[model samples]
Target: MTQNERIFLPWWKRVVIVIATVIVFALQIMLFVFAFQVNFDFPFNVWIYWIIEGGSFVLVYHIIHRPILTNYKLTWSILILIFPLPFSLLYYLNQRSLALPKYKQKKIDTILGNYYNPNQIDCTLELDRKDPKAAKLARILRSSTGYPLWKNTKYTFLFDGLLKHEDMLVELKKATRYIFIECFIISDGKLLSELLPILKEKGDAGVEIKIIYDDLGSKATLKKKTILEIAQIKNCTFTNYNPLGLNINPAFNYRDHRKMVIIDGKTAYCGGDNLADEYIHQKKRFGFWRDNCGKYEGEAVQSFIALFIEMWYISTKMVLKLENYLCDYVLERETSYILPFGDGPSNGAEPGYDIFRSLISSADQTLYISTPYLIIDEAMIESIVLAAKSGVDVRILMPGIPDKKVAWYLGRFHYKDILLAGGKIYEYTPGFNHAKNIIVDGRYAFIGTINMDYRSLFLHYECGALILLDNEIYKMKDDFLKACDDSKPITYEDWKKRPWWQKLISYLLYLFAPLF
Candidate 1:
C-alpha cells in the first residue's frame, strides 16, 4: 500500500480500535487488582502481605535514591505508594535495559574511549582563561558525554528548512565514501522522494549509505514498499531503532530522537528538521513550519561520526571500525569551538538535561530559546526564573499553531512563572516553530535535535553541537530576534486573563508533563 493511503485508518476503525484498547486495559487493571488484593489461605496470605510490604519499602527507597529528576522520582514514588503491589513490579520491570545488552554497551564505551582520552586540554585551558563560564560548561559536557571541545571547525546556521533541504542535497551528492542519516521521523513524502533517489544513486555508485529511523516515530508514515526499496538498494543499510512490540520493558518509552546527516566524515547537518514533507513546507501541517538546521565541517564532524557509529552498533550488532570513517584532515579555522555530543539510555547520565541547565545557568546577558515543547521539570524552571530575576534578557519562542495540543497546554502552564519573573515568552504567529535552538549572550549557541521536553532530555537518544564564541552564534541571535518579532508575546496580564477552561486544562496536563 502507498504511504498516504495506509498511514491513517478510517474513522470507524480508529474508534473501534480505541474502544478495544481501553476495554482491554481496564480489564487488565481489574485482574491485576484482584490477583494482588484477594485473600488467600492464612499462611499464604500472610506471606504475600509481608512480601508486598517489604518490597514496597525497598522499591520506594531505590526510587528516591535514583539519579533521575526530582519531579520524576516524586511522581513515581506517589504512584508506587498508591498502588504498591503492581507499581513496584512495574518499576522493577521498567528499570531493566533490554534494548542495550552488555556487549553493545561495552562496545559503545570502547568507541568513546578513543575520543575521550585525548581531551582538548589546550582549547579548554584557553576557554578557561578567556571565559570561565564557557570553560565550565565545556568541561561538564566533555566529562559527561566524552566528546571533547574542538577548534578549527566551520559552522553554518541554516535558518530555513528549505535552505537545509537544498544544502543537504548538495552535501549528499558530494559523498565519496559514506553517508550516515539518522532521524526520529523518516516518512514517505516529498522530502524522502527527493532524498531516496540520491541515496540510491550514491549507494549504487559504491558510496556506503547507513540510515537509522525510530520505528515508533515513523511507524505511521513509512510504507512497506519504502522499507523494501531501501533494503534492496546496493551498498545501503537501513536499520530501525527500538522496534515497538508487545514487550513491557521501559525501552518502549525511549526513542532515538537524534537527527543528523553526515557525509564522508567531512561534513555534517544537525538540527530539528526531519525527513518529512511538513518539515520543508512541501506540505504544511500547521501553517508555516518554522524550523532551523545547521551545517558544519572540520574537526567537530568527527564527533558526529562517533555518535553515528555508537548508535549503528546498537541497532545492528556489526561493529564499525572507529578509525575507518574519521576525517583525516582538519580545516584549521580558528573561528569558534564546537563540541558534538550524544546522550541516551545507554549511559545513566542525563547529559542533554545537564547541557541545557548549564547553558541557562551561564547566561550573562541574554538567553534565547526556541522549542516545540517546553515540558521541563522544576529545576530547569528554577534556572530560567533565576536568570530572569538576575536581569538576563530571557526570551522563549514557542509554537502558535500546535501539533500536539496537550503538550502545548502543558507548555502554557509554566508561562505564569516565567512572566512573573521578568522573562518574555513568544509564540510564533506564523506557524509551528519546530526549531530547537539556544543562544546565550550571542557568544554561545546550541543547534540540534534536542528539545526542551522530558522525553528529549531524559528518555530519548539525542545529539547536538555546542558552539562557543563563534560568529555563528551571532547569526543565531539575529535569527532568534527576527523570529521573536514574528511571534506574539505573552505578558503577565495576558497570562492572567487567559480563559478559565484553558487554565484548568493546562493545570490538569501539568501532572502528566514528565511522562509526555
Candidate 2:
C-alpha cells in the first residue's frame, strides 16, 4: 500500500513529534519569563499571560509524557523530579478540574410535533423509474423529512448574473413587507451598484430590510464605511458575520457562506452566484466565469425566509416577527418543486453531511459532481469508492488551474485511488470551475454555495436547494455533459507516474487536510 493508504503513524515520526513537544514546552517557559518582565506593573495582565503560557507547558507535558504518566510510580517520580512545589500544585489543580465530571442534563423532547399536514401538501414529484438511482436523484428535490419545508413554491433558474441583478432589483422595488439579504461576498461592482440604489429606495419607502455579509470574505472587496453609510442613509440594518482580527475566535472557521435574497417572505433567490460581476462574466479573470442561480416563489419561499431570519437573528441579535413580515403579499405560484435547506455547524440532529451521504449511497446508475475544492473527508471518499465498486458510473469534475495550489494538489492525490476503484476524474482545461453542483442519475440536481470540502461539511454555514425532477435538473445535466465534452480524463497509470517531488508535496498536504 502507498503512504496515503496507510492509517498508522511511523515510529520515526512519533519520535520526532515527542521531540517537538519538548521544544514547545521550553519556548512557553521563555514566553512566561519575558511576559513577567514587561507586565510586572500590571498584575492582571501578568496573570493572564502566565495563565496562557503555563497552560501551554502543561498541555505539551501531558501529551509527551502521557504513556509514562499513566503509571502511578513513574508519575510520582517525574513530578517530584521535574516541577517545583508551587508549579506542581497548580498543574494538579488544573488537571483535576479538567477531569471532573459536571452535571448532566436530560435531553428535552420539545416536539413541535408534526405541525405539517403532508396530505395538504402536494410537493413530491413522482418519478417514472423505480430504480435506486432514480429514487435517490428524486429525493434531492423532495421536501426534507422535517417540518414540510419548501412546499408550494415557484423556482426560476437565472443564467446570467446581470439579469439576476436586474430581477432582484425589480423584486426589491415590489416588496411591501420585508427584505433579507445574506452573502459571503458583496463587492463594490456594477451588480452591487445597480442593486444598492434599489435597496436604499425600498428601505426609505418603509420596507423592512436586513443585510448580513461575511467580514473576511469581503475584506479586500468592500469598505466598512460604504456599508455603514448605506445603513445610516437608508434606514436599513447591516451586520458583519465573523470579523477578522487578532482577538477573533478560531471558531471563525464557521462562516456564513451563502448568498440569498428574500423579498416580503414571498419570493426568494439563491444559488452559486455571489453579489459580484465576475460571477456573471462581466469582469472575467481566468475565463468567462460561468455560474448558475435560482429564484423561487411559493411555499419554498417560506423556508428561504426562515433561513434568512435565523441568520439575521444570529448576526443582529434581534428577533423578527413572522406575522408582521409574512402576511397577504406572498406570491402563490404552481409550477416547480423547491426545497431550500440551510447547513451549518449547529445542525446537531439533521446535519447536511448526512443528507449528502444518503443521496450518494442511494445512487444506482450514475453520479456527477463538480466542485472547485475537493478536500473530502474519509467518509465521503469511502462513499465515492463504494459507489464506483458497485458498477455505478461515478464522475467528478475539478479545475485544471486552481485558486489554491495546495488544495488542488491534495485533490490530485486522490485521483489514483478513485480511478483504481473504477471512477472517472476530469479536469476542466479552460479555466477554474467555481461551480459547486451535483447531478445524480440525470433526475436530481443540487446547486448552491457549499463546496465539497472540510469547511463546507463540518465548519462553514451554507445553504442550497435540491432540484428533484424539475425542469432545472434537465438544464443542469445538459450543462454537465457539455462540460465533460470539453474536459480531459485522468487515468490511474497517468497519476501513478506523477513526478516524485510533486507526490512528496501532496503527501505532506494530506497530513494537514483536516486543518484546511
Candidate 3:
C-alpha cells in the first residue's frame, strides 16, 4: 500500500534465508537440549556438565578481568552459576567485542585529537576566575575525556520537542556547506515529513549531508529503501550505525544512542528528542509526550562536529577534514561556559556517567533529574544518596506511563532508600517523560542524551552539554520544578508499603537490570 519500493525475493535468496533460519533454530534447540542433560544421571551427562562448567569458569575469569563495573561483573557471575553454558557463551561473546575494532579506534583517535581545537588555555583561566567547583569538574572531564571547557557559547534551552524542531529548521536552513545528523530513532511521520523536505531542498542546492541512525532503534519505522533514496541525493551519504541482521551477536547491544545535529560546524543541537512524532506530540501514543533539547552556538559546536565526524568515519569509512567545516563566522560573546562531551565503546572512561556523578557530587542547594528509566549502578546510587543525605534537595522526575512495564516496576525497588535519605521521586501524571536532564543548584545544568541508566551510561554511545553560569540553568531548574508541580510525589512510607509480590518481582527484575 505504501508508495515506497518493495523487494521481491528470488528463489535462491529465499532458499538461503530459509536455510539460515533453520540452522539457527536447530542450534538453539540443541543448546537447550544439551543444557537439559545436566539433570540426567548418565556418564555422558557428567561430561556435558563439566564441559559447560569449564566454559563458564573460563568466562568468569575473563569477566573478572574486564575493567567493567563491579555490579555488572557480579551479575554475570551469578548468571553463570544458574545457567553455566548460555551465560558463559554470552560473557565470552560480549566481553571480547565491547571494544571497537582497532582500525576504527585508530581513526577516531586521529580525528578526535588532531582536528579538535578545545581552546583549553583560555577556558582554564575563565574557570579559575569565576567558578572553582566548575574548574575542578572541567579538569576531571579533560583528563578523563579530552572534551575541553568552551567559552562564549550561547545556550537556548527548549523544554519541548516541537520548539526544538523549530530551532532545528532555522539552523538547517542556514547551512551553506554541510549538515550532519545522528540519532537513535527515525520514523516516517509528522516530524520526518517536515524534516525530509528541508534536507532534500538543501541537498539539491549542493549542500553536503550525512546521516547515521541506529539500525535496531529504527527497525520498524525506517525502511532500507528510504535510506537508499536519501543516499542518492547529491553529496549525501547515509548508513545504519550497526546493522541488525540474522547473526546472533551480543555486539548489537552497544548501540549509538546519541542524538546530535551539527549544522556547518557552528551551531549544534543535542537532547532527548529523536525523529519521531511522539517526541513532538504530533500524534501522541501515551498521553502528553514530554521531551527536552538544548541548542548551542559558538565554540562548543566544535565538539559536536568532532562527534559527528567520528561516527561518520566509522559507519561510512570516509573521513573529512574538520578545518574545512569549522564555523568561519565569529559568535556573539556570552558569559556562560559550555563543554560538549561524548561517551562510547571508543573509550574505557565513561565520560557521560562521570559528568553526571560530578554534577551530583557538586550539588549544593538542589539536585534534580528527569529520565525515562531509573536503572542506576551502585556507584550512582551511592552518589545520589550521599548527595541527599548531605542536605541537598534531590528530586527525580520519572515517567508515570512507562514504555517498558517490567523495568518501570523494577525502578521502584531503588526508591525506598533514596526517599529515606531526603530524596524525592515524582512520576509525571500526564504521560511519558523522556527527558534526560540534570540540574545542580540552579547554577549548572546538563541536558542531552545521557540517560541515568545502565544501558545508556555503560554500553551505548552518548553525548551531553555541560552548562555553567548560563542563565538557561535557571530555566532548566524551572522546567523540573514545573514537572514536579504537575506530578505525584512518592514518600518513603509509600515506597515501603508496596505489596510483597510486587517487591519480589521488582527485586527479581533489578537483579538482571545491569544487562538491560
Q: Which lDDT tens digits does candidate 1 get at residues 146-171? A: 78898878999999999999999998
Using lDDT as the yardstick, the better of models 1 and 2 is 1
Per-prediction TM-score to the true structure, in the order listed: 0.89, 0.74, 0.89
Candidate 2 lDDT by residue in tens digits, 1-516: 122322333466566555654665576577667878888888888887666556545554553444311112222323322443554453443231232122110101121222333533333333223234444433533433343434356666675566677788888888877788899998887887777788777778888778899988888888767777667846588888867677524445567898998887778888777887787667767665656678887666666666676666566556665445554444554434456677764343224555566667767788888888788655567788999999989999888767787888888887876899999998887767777787777666677788887667656778887766567677777777777778778888888888898899888776556445
Poorly placed runs, candidate 2 (over 4 Å): 1-147, 159-163, 246-250, 327-336, 497-499
TM-score winner between 1 and 2, please give it.
1
Q: In model 2, what is the error at residue 463, expressed in angstroms?
A: 0.7
Per-prediction CA RMSD (Å): 9.3, 9.0, 10.8
Once fitted onto the true fold, the runs of candidate 1 whose alpha carbons sit more than 4 angstroms away are: 1-54, 89-99, 116-119
List, residue by residue over 1-516, the lDDT tens digit for candidate 3.
Answer: 011111233365446545644664465457656766755666677566667766665776676566666556667866775577677767655553454777778877887667545468777887878888988777777777787788868889999999999889988998889999999998888888788888999999999998899988999988677777777877888889878777776667688999999898778999999999988888768778889999988888988888888878867788877777886657766577888888887776677777788899899989999998888875677789999999999999999888887878888888988998989999998999899998999888789998878888878888988888888889988888999999999998888888898899898777588877
Between candidates 2 and 3, the one scoring higher on lDDT is 3
lDDT of each: 0.83, 0.66, 0.81
In candidate 3, residue 87 scores what lDDT? Answer: 77
